[model samples]
Target: MNMSTELIGMVAGGVSTAAFLPQALRIWMTKNARDISLLTYCILGLGNVFWIIYGIEKSSLSLVFTNSFILITALVIVYMKYFIIKD
Candidate 1:
């Protein structure tokens, strides 16, 4: 609620969301995810989904928004690993 707490939350959310952007962009551009771990992404995506659910239940905007974005990225990676790479 305080300015400092809000700032920290925004920063944390921004950083966490941004962390996955490069990997998503790489997969989108290269059309390759051969080296990516399918299991890891699957687990991470599931975890992201749970976080989104928790965020919704708790009414936490930061958690919801950040985890939703992460979920999207995770799904993309999973798709690439399974479908695009084809290996």
Candidate 2:
């Protein structure tokens, strides 16, 4: 991978995934996933899974690494949304 592309992914993924942290923290703290959109997160989690696969196909470690972390975290949010989030 080119330095530029890696840098871009690092920037985008770092920012986006880091952005996911506050909601995660909130969900963990309050066990409240009410504000989280189940469908949106589900789709997002699936998208991340596909991203990891695509990363593997492309032999892109950064994409795989970032997406893996995001997928787990997002799945956690999804789970919390199911169990903790009130309808």
lDDT of 2 at 53: 98
Q: Estimate the Cα RMSD of every predicted model relative to the unseen true structure.
A: 2.0, 2.1
> Candidates' TM-scores?
0.80, 0.81
Residue-level lDDT of model 1, residues 4-74, one tens digit each, is 76567667988988998899888778877778887888898889899989878876777888888888888
Candidate 1 overall Cα lDDT vs. reference? Answer: 0.82
Candidate 2 lDDT, tens digit per residue, 10-55?
A: 7888887898889889888886766778788889889999999999
lDDT of every model, 2 decimals: 0.82, 0.85
Q: How many steric clashes does model 2 contain?
A: 0
For model 2, what is the alpha-carbon lDDT of residue 60?
A: 82
In model 1, the runs with Cα more than 4 Å from the true position are: 1-7
